[model samples]
Target: MAQNQFSLFKQKFFSSFFITQALGALNDNIFKSALLIFIAFRAGDELGLNSDLLNNIAAGLFIIPFFLFSATAGQIAEKYEKSALIRKIKVLEIVIMALAVLGFFLNNIWFLLGILFLMGFQSSLFGPIKYSILPQHLSDKELLGGNGLVEMGTFLSIIIGTVIGGVLIGFDELGVRILSVLLLVVSACGYLASRRIPETPSAQPYLKINWNPITETWRTFQYARANRVVFLSILGISWFWFYGAVFLTQIPNFTKVSLNGNENVATMILATFSVGIGVGSALCEFLSGRKVELGLVPFGAIGMTWFALDIYFANPTSSYIGELGPSAFLSQDGAVRTLLNCAFVGIFGGFYIVPLYALVQERCDKSHLSRVIAGNNILNAFFMVIAAALAAVCLGNGMTIPQFFMLTAILNAVVAIYIFSLIPEFLMRFLIWILINTIYRVKKTGLENVPEEGACVVVCNHVSYVDALIIGGTVRRPIRFVMYHKIFKVPVLSFIFRTAKAIPIAGHKEDPELLNEAMYSIAEALDQGEVVCIFPEGKLTSDGDMNEFKSGIERIIEKTPVPVVPMALQGLWHSLFSRKKVNKFIDRLKRLRTKVTLVVAEPISPDEANREHLYTVVKELRDDKP
Candidate 1:
């Protein structure tokens, strides 16, 4: 609906909600960053404790609340109207910030740690409401963009807050006073922004509340696992948090000890990473064509691992002579490479995370959506806690920070492989994505004519061997394509076809049993309410021209009687995958990045969806383009 993710800022409802959530993130990071710095620098002197031990303690304190409170929070989000609930949470933030001010003024480490726990608690309660409300407000077409904007805003706030907290907390008492006042102001502003958010009605108004965190937590995980893809998406998301926690948690020390950089240098590296994520998040709408494209997940995983491993090799040892400031650090050997690697890691991380969030929001049942998000928060916290522990164990066992980073990167690749293997959808989509983006520039028209949900048989004129992949990648839903049995078994593409659950059919002379099996499967798919795409001509054309309609489509309609949507693929005839070969060198060269179009016409009723009528519709849609 909107032109892009940026256009979301123009609407009052979206803008206000964005500001409210961003401010909340900002305040959380400011307080947490200030506390971590205090514990690292000042708390050790005052409390006579190991700074490292205290820092670990501080991290655990913040994360413990999510494990303890996320279940109850998910239920609360589901059972209440969201806007008012957000306002109340913002008010609670004001209260928490007030306590934070008292702790800062008194310079009490224990009291401040308590406030940190409370901050995490507030975040736990807000997590479900934060994500689940987007689907309620934004159209399906806008979901990816909306999530992208939110991710960008959240990361930007994180870096800004981290920088502000690090700088402000450095000035001793004056810094404490300024931070105290700033915290209250930001909290107040967040509350005011919350007040402007439009009401989001409850998804489960009559649902009973679960008070026990232990039982409710287990039940929440079950809710997440209700949909297998959604569950894997949550796991993928959690793995990202683990990867991020290891990298981000070690940055300050990584800069200080490994790079021999001062606090300012550490802040600069963190800022670079955060900014890269923001840029990547903002790029998702364009890259995914405003759809929840799972293809980007694998792409992002590869980049995250590549850049993270580069960070290890860029500076594996703490060999620098003296503590360098930001400028001097930038001038060091391999410094720019290290920073760029960090930035790309964040960039790919943004690409990895945004779509999964959108997928969870789109696929999960609305009633239990909030709870599933709560499960996500619980797992995220669990992973982060494990990351911290893993870092401690690895570093304590005589591993350098760079070695730890290398380990995390290697672990990321392993996990990505494992998850993708479990759900080949991610990899299949990635393959399709690469095929379309590299070989062709696709321009789609009338895609909205296809139904968003329910059973429908799409009739498209087949032009090339890769026609199914193009159609599958372009359409917004999963499609079970029917293809010739021999073509279905074509080596590499066979994996994609099987993963997509495509039905393979044979002619009566070739294999009558296979033909009967295919028809039954098609009927079964329609009975279960899925989109099944079939080429009415029953095979690809040798030349780029329409073929006569086959009556098999009529039998499909008679058995299932679902609405049939007509579609056409144009410009693909010239592709290398097509049977037609180009003898001219210029024509061969032009095959790369060929411009292609896929056109869809309105759905026709079953009674009118004869092979002849559908063929005419597709031919007209493809007119002058092929």
Candidate 2:
């Protein structure tokens, strides 16, 4: 698996993708950091402007574009092939880099500031395409791995960019020119990489275009609104950015005043955090079993909150300003602990975010993927602005750094509770998962008979609504169910199913496109080593017996040469939600009190998996109640 990850990076297309993304991130941070630093020092009388006002203006310049341009960018992505669009965006980056160079050389703070805003604009346009394209070029299973690599590349690039920007500005004569040239080169390289990207056609090729920023932005929100789970995940994602931006903006001051460290020491602390995010991002692939597993999102958030609070408690009370060298940092126990705390937050941040991002990618409508991403970016920018405003108010009102940290930590709990309440699936999945983990001792036999990893078509009888949940709860790996469209839309169940990336399938007469998409998605999932579950009976048995199997499973097997896992749910069909008659009012009487059993038989090979043969095998297993 590790070798596969490394090999992915070595692939020409993936390598190009990595370089373009990483360098774009690097350039963004380099100029933004340098411009911010320069303005902080010279915004006042040195440039005949109010220092604080100019600094605030600079912040707005960068963020405002996300609100203004992301929608249009998303439209362009959906209207055109992504590879070609990316190539054009890279060219735009090169222009922006040149303007950045010009701004720096002239020491025209106003012009340089304009360039920063343009960089933000450029990034806004790129944001939608960035996420939407992953579902296109990569196989379904590679989504997590692909997302991890992109995130790692992005953050590592950011660390290097900021550090390089900070260091380069210290030079007397040629620093600005050198930085500009470097950014231009990087942008050009990104263009080269983008050119290598394969073609990805638009999902909404004939959809009417909307170019007005504000109107389109509102429309994007509406599009997101139509997909409730996607919308909430967007909010969750936005909230995460808010949380991160606040901490990031404080690093310089936190390092100096709180940690009593020099700039270099502060940089190292920042590096630790960046490296942690990269490590955590990579870890998501393995933890999620290469599927877009949202179970890990809550897991990640828990770590982020815990570690962030620990950092506040971990702060040293006394100053160590004079003792600011690398050697001093290494020697000081407090500094070591502080650095570790910073790294912990970053690592957990990776855990918290990567899955959410992958979930958004895998579950969103392919055509509207970019638009949804744009809405997400807009909300992200809005939340970040709020975070900045809140931080400013808190700091201005005489809150100490540690106190602010503590408050943010506490607020995280409140925010989490609110979001989880609004969408209970996170909590619900965790509950059932915990129940399975605690109440039942699950054992897998012939696990090796099932392909260890890669996409497989899991054929089973539709025993109950909780069949998917039960399989998800007990399977050692994540599974994507190709379920009847309406069942997937059930109120509470819909949220959980979407979060789990279950593909909603309709019959030919109902929604042919969706049906085709589901079929293709199955192949895509298997191609990615994802576990795709499909009930051969298509729906729950109306009678208390399994129906004849459908041919869809057979077709899927023929298309994808991967193994097929034949399984049975022994006792769950007897539960209330199944075909068995129940006193509806009384059923609620014993909801949690009832116990259920789920059993998995060994996987059968594609050649051995004919409908009659596998149907008999599963029927025999289902009949064996124990």
Candidate 3:
């Protein structure tokens, strides 16, 4: 399915793993909801515990293992084959579920709580395996689609599990028996499916198991932060979990006390949120054109804050003793709009999470991938705990849910802007992506001519200031541009160039040291197996005619004997960045949505990549459509 992202789900490994993980998620939600509902509604007063408070306690117990055992789990995943470990975890799940059967039979709250802790432990172990295994089985392009499917499966399973568990626990003593039997069967099914997952070799098979969670946790955290982007992405992902936990937890009481709805109405609201998540996950791959697009992250953050604000304003002040059925709720002013807003929040959340997870998988060091993921899980658990506490603190201080929603929405905007400011690359790429896609209808020919791997010198006709932007955006491979020093410093475009690491060159007559440094940077980039791009024409065309090619290409190829691919840009001079009409910025803005075409020619061997030879090739290609 490397050729087709959606077909990835039809493959054997992805399908089996999808089912196995989905079942695990389903079993978790089913057991958790059933137990929580049982405690809230049916647990006898003999225990002498507050139902609502115990509910929160149960939630905390389930996440505590993540904080304590994630390091050990990471080591285990690193030290052993993932599929075998998954099978063993599943078998443990069966045993735990069997124990849960007896605990439910006796209606023993302590025993059930213990089972909940074990379930959390099981999930903690599974978390590292869940993400790290994707890079091994799927291609980079397939990572986004695979993650989308996994997210869809998880949320769809949550909806089913929540509904089924709610209904089953609604029964009398017979419900306990039925719930126990059902959990046992689901655990067994998960084990069976785990058996079918293809073997993925351990990333660190020779690693020693570190049993000390505290010390090992510190080491894992260090490795995770070693990469700046990965660490920042972890923070963004954690914030999403924090946002989600607070929003979802308030739904039940908000539905009952605020919307005046019973359990049925609450279920409908949850189902709507889940449906929206599933839709967003399913559509992400197509929307991204099967790439791990970072642009969607900001797009998602924008929608999330907006929808959250809408939810607050939708029903700013409303409370009732009785209930509004689904029909009556829809009849109320802004009721459907509120539900839709909540649903869209989940939808954008899918966009926010899928790419970040895929980016980590694609970018993180393979040896420490599991540990990084474990650290991420730990941090996510920590942030979620903080979110719960924050919500409690606010409500305890007399903050209404509507007011809290407004506050959280405002906070979300602040957090997003701060994070984006720290890593302007996300915002820069987003702007370039939006500019290219919206301002120009870009067409490409012979994209296959560009090498898919290894270092190559991409020599292209530089007709406009945004040439690198267009080429980099459309090319499958990441390229480092060798660009003009002045253009590379054009305020907003400077951030774009610097973030892309575009080498800034000048003639020796102007700045000899800067030119020399740029040459070395180009060689270093090539040596590191990156595509190094140069505008051999040296400057943007003055009359839509090719200039004499520079010796810069020949000089660089002499130091790094790599393949040279020649490309041409046509239909660009009339736009804003060109000299067609004095190259005014406002002029380009006026011509937004103009058409441009990029053409790539076959690569030339290093020995044949002379200034004259390359110049002829580029000249011929540029003159093709002019």
Candidate 4:
């Protein structure tokens, strides 16, 4: 496995695909930005039209294609090879740019706006294939990193392309000529890059095409909703886009009216926000240990809310005679704080989005992934439209941009709490993430031994009260642990345990009914192809020593008849949650940041998973470490 996301750049396949997609994003933004800028500045005089009305029309035109053609695009992507499809899309971009050159030369706003609609049409077609192809080429471990790089490249391209477009359009006829040439060249380069993407076979080649947008769109949504987690993840991703659109659309005006800043200051703030998103997106691979870590989603949400609120509070009162330039803006009181707020909000937005994208890819059925992504695109566009309307309503009603920012932040908090409440897994993973990251540096080995799918009973030597948590956090898959009822009821930890759906048990003499129910639950979980981990010792070790494995493991394996994997937890005995005696305050200090290791051994066949054999295997794996 590649140790870091950067290593992926060294591979030709990933690099080619990344560049192709990034350039595509760049070209789309460049064209759209140039047209928007022209509409804002020169179009009203040249075309004798209302600029605001024209701007809204342009925005509406661009978004309409996503709604009209996304379902058809999804079906087409599923039925054909992705690489060829990408090259064709790039060719279409070249044709669109050629027409755009004519539109610019003639100074015809209607013609250019028509070209803008075509750009959106092209993008809607490419959307499904863009994400679906990643899974075809990348491994499960590379998925998160690949997504992070793509997101970083995309946002950076948006910033760079938008800036370049604005700057190029500012010059006279010469600027129009230069912009036209740049558009064609970028489109050609994107085509060249697409040529190098390794061929990916169709996912559902035999499927019939659905041409009707209305019915097909409904079917696409049903595909997305087929998996409950994936559906919610789509909603989460769309919500982020909604949140992001609101912030991005208001930045220029906010800088002008609220910050008393010139165009240069606005550009500077926009660059900071985009760069923050890039940095945060790149950091996801590192923070997640190259897996799709859902914990980062909640973490990202909290940061977005906090920083957005700060932006509201960071609004400065100092009045300038004229709009300040970039340097002057920076010198103004509360400027840096506002910039920091923008950057952190962007960073958390990255964290909020990347994992959800990965999860959608990882969980959605391969055959329907393209369609599901198409469904996501439709929702994303819809949400962005709503965002625009909301922003207009709020700003039109005399709400200060800062107050609007505050309102957005508060809405974000409410939405996040509601989503996490609906899917407690995100919150549960967050708590587990906090515990392991803060108090322990976990080193996991032989995790590949755990089966990627299907039922398996994992038996670990229980050392401390937090062994299950450590194991739960480290493993890539969700696990239902059979734990002691007493430990399950621990004050702070109880919430996490119950949310995790941990099975609680007691001895026959202690509580026979509860023990039988626990056993039945474990068996049923395995029957449903879930992973169930149990401490075969039946409880935490009291003296930092291995206890004899109980016959419960045998009984469960006999009932389920599944593979049994033995695991060991080492170096957690002295941790704060352990039963180890701490005689002094200094001893407590030593427990912080303890180095912990979780070792997973190969699965033992059902026939060989007896009490004695499994105990010896777990002991050997622990290497006598407490």
**Of the candidates shown, which would achieve the greatest TM-score relative to the real structure?**
1
By summed lDDT, which 10 consecutive residues of candidate 1 come out lowest?
314-323
What's the true lDDT of residue 194 in model 2? 84
For candidate 1, write residues 1-626 as lDDT tens digits: 67788888887779999999999999999999899889888988888879978887888888898989999999999999999999999999999999999999888999999999999899999999999999998888889999999999999999999989988999988999999999999999999999999989999999999899999999988877878999999999999999988877889889988899987888888889989888888888899888999999999999999999999898889555448998888888899999999999999999999999999999999999999999999999999989988987888899999999999999999999999999999999999999989999999999999998999999999888889999999999889999998889999999999999999998878899999999999999999999999988988888899898899899999999999999988888888788887899998888889889999999999999998788889999998544
Q: What is the TM-score of each candidate against the true structure?
A: 0.97, 0.75, 0.93, 0.96
Give lDDT: candidate 2, residue 429: 65
Higher-ranked by TM-score: 1 or 2: 1
Worst 10 residues of 3 by lDDT: 314-323
- Report the Cα lDDT for residue 318, model 2: 31
lDDT of 3 at 371: 88
Greater TM-score among 3 and 4 belongs to 4
lDDT for 141 (candidate 2)? 65
Model 3 clash tally?
2
Candidate 2, 1-626: lDDT as tens digits: 22345568766667787888888999898888787777776556467787778878988999999888888888888888777878888999999888888778788999988888888888998899888887777766677888888998999998999999877776635877677778888888888878887777887888777879899989889988887778888888888888888778877678777777788877887899899999999888766545666666777777778878887888834344534756776786666777787888888889778878887887788878988898899999999999998999998998877778778778877887787787776776665555444443334333344565667777777867767876786565668989999999988778778878999998888899998999898888888889988899877987668899988788888888777777777655446567666667766455443465454577777888888887998787676442
Ordered from best to worst TM-score, the candidate numbers read 1, 4, 3, 2
In candidate 1, how many Å is residue 28 off? 0.8
RMSD of each candidate?
1.6, 9.6, 2.6, 1.8
Q: Report the candidate with higher lDDT, 1 versus 3.
A: 1
Q: Candidates' lDDT values, in order?
A: 0.92, 0.79, 0.87, 0.91
Q: Which of 1 and 4 is ahead in TM-score?
A: 1
Return whichever of 2 and 4 wins on TM-score: 4
For residues 247-305, write the lDDT of model 3, one tens digit per residue. 77888777887788787888899888887887888778876767787878888888889
- Residue pairs clashing in model 1 are none
